[model samples]
Target: MEKLQSPARDIHPDTRNGLHPVTLLNRNNLTLLDTGTSAEQFLQQKISNNIAQGHQDAFYVADLGDIKQKHWRFMKELPRVKPFYAVKCNSTNEVLQMLATLGTGFDCASMGEIDMVLRMGVPAADIVYANPCKQVSHIKYAAAHGVCKMTFDCEAELFKIAAFHPKAEMILRIATDDRDAWCALSSKYGALVEQCEDLLKTAKNLNIQVIGVSFHTGSGCKNTHSFCKAIEDARKVFEIGKKLGYQMRLLDIGGGFSGNSEFRPTFEEFADVIRQSLNQYFPNNKEVEIISEPGRYYVESAFTVALNIITKKEVYEKGADGNSRRKFSYILNDGVYGTFLDFYLVKEKQKLKPLLGKDFATEQELFPSNLWGPTCTNVDKLVNEFYLPELETGDWVIFPNMGAYSISMSTTFNGFPQPKVYFVLSKGDE
Candidate 1:
């Protein structure tokens, strides 16, 4: 039998009283941390996102050493905007528990997610079955569980829901063209504006209560205009509903909030754009409730993935002019199989920083390097070409702005177990 390589061990390059790569990378330069504080200690001081103590190695720890539970940033500038977390982002018990306690409702896409939220002690009324295409079984489940609200984009879905769950409250998911956004939702769900009247008539005939309208502009939307256009489209739907004597009570501006540190829009700024548009469309409609499904916005900047640097090599590649260009490569124990599957497989851009240990020496030794996961496949590379301080095997790296879609999207592709999660808590609360 061939000998298998052991998972990469943590590298300690030198012996000196220094900081871990995790700490150094998060310092003022990276802005991942406000001060040059240890990960454990920084986890302790914050109040709103406080993590409880003592479960560092557990698969699920609400408070990992010093991490806070509420590190997620809400829309501070638009405090009036309430966020309904898209559950598909990260449905882990710890993540769900933290969000639930924060008093945020859930935006569930399936009966399973609805069940999960209900199990967490969330009221059925607090969930929005946001998936436009739902299975008959899911419709039955939601109806049986008293989760009356859901989304639909077509007459077929409305009929399906009415057949299986006659009393279901519903929302019409309108399709908007957001060619400028990173990931548009038109390919998957929502109905065209022309079909709104027919869909509403069908809903009325089937006795399925049509109470609201919803639309998803798409994920990673850089153009704020996409949101404005969606609101405009939703207004048309509201007007149609009013003509049919159906008073729309809810407006779910679906999830598409980006949190990649490089592309992040402040919650306040985003809320301002959304709210301003809504007011223009439905001014003084205090009887109607405005809601948003924000997945990445709330959780993206809250956590960091601490990975162990395993191996390093310097290589050169041919440039456009056939010149040899040197580049460094640093392999780490965790990869796409663990927390970064999206970036690894989809070539999604991610931010990386070094986590130097306390006994390390010579910060100047760190160099620009490519990071790879522990898989034997060549495709297992996490960052194809990234700059970093010179680092050896056993050193650690911290990937911040990693709290949103990454965790929920992780897979066990290479058979490696998922990394442990720990929450930090605020100081005075503890």
Candidate 2:
């Protein structure tokens, strides 16, 4: 491996504090404040997320210091809407407690998750067991704990719940599409319109209370029109339930809110769509409740990942014509074995920038760099190709928009400990 060299010009002024690369890249670029100021500052100093100044929260924040004290603190003091933090996104105790404080509920996928939320002092009523595929043990656990509200998409699951938990409250998971979804979730879960009618009939026969219709347009949903389509689907389901003597009391528009994309629908616009859908579908029903499950939209910008550069190497690649392309590789102390497994396994795109100290000056020279995590396996690479200022051994790097899937998908592969997490609150002194 050869060393990749940096250019000779200085892009930024020299400073005394250590300069992480990210700060130098966006010293004056215009970007939204997704993480809030307190979080941005805290992350700038502690993690590698290269957060810019003047950023504020758009959704919710979870404190990481006390791993057992998960809570969701809303950025805006909005009224009339409750956030059901999707537990699958990151169910650390710290995250859960943070949400609990914000009066948010849990959208659980399994019995273990439900129990975890219950142990955290969140009442069973505040939980929506949203997993469409319910194991017998999970159903039994819900029944035993007096958690009667859950989701089902198929007749088999409805029958299982009816036989074991006859009084369970149920929601039919309906499939919908968004023309602008990064990852649509309809293939794995949710029932089609035709299937929804049969599932509702089964629910009625089993004496289950069908309270609502839920739809997930999928993750990274950018178009508000997709939400509108889902709302229309929910209306259809509601009408079918009405004909069967089942009163639909709730509408759960499931998670798919985008946090990383530069293009996103305004919350006001999203809220208006939901409001209009409700007004158009159930004009006389003021008792019907509208619920939304948003995970990435709330927490993706709240946290940052800080990693330390352990070693540097240069690799030379030979082209077909015998030309050579040189690159620099920086091995960091953390990788897929720690809090970034999703980045590797799922090939998820992550934003990388340098965490520059105040006194650090930016080097004008550009170098193609590959970031490797500190795992023994050859597969622990974080970023294959990235442009950065000249970085040497012991330099620290930061990645932003890492709050959603990073930690939740981490593993102890190669035996590396997970990175420490901290939450920064902006409210006046507690």
Reference-based lDDT, each prediction: 0.66, 0.66
Please report how far candidate 2 places residue 383 from its true position, in Å.
1.5
Tens-digit lDDT string for candidate 2 (9-118): 22122322332221111212212222333444454443222323322111122323221122222223223346688988877555566667557788988988888888
**Per-prediction tally of clashes:** 41, 37
Q: What is the TM-score of each candidate against the true structure?
A: 0.79, 0.80
Backbone clashes, candidate 1: 41
Give the worst 10-residue stretch by lDDT in candidate 1.
1-10
- Model 2 segments beyond 4 Å from truth? 1-37, 43-80, 178-180, 261-263, 266-269, 318-325, 345-363, 428-430
Distance (Å) between predicted and true CA of 264, model 1?
4.6
Candidate 1 per-residue lDDT over residues 144-172, each given as its tens digit: 99998799998889778878998888999
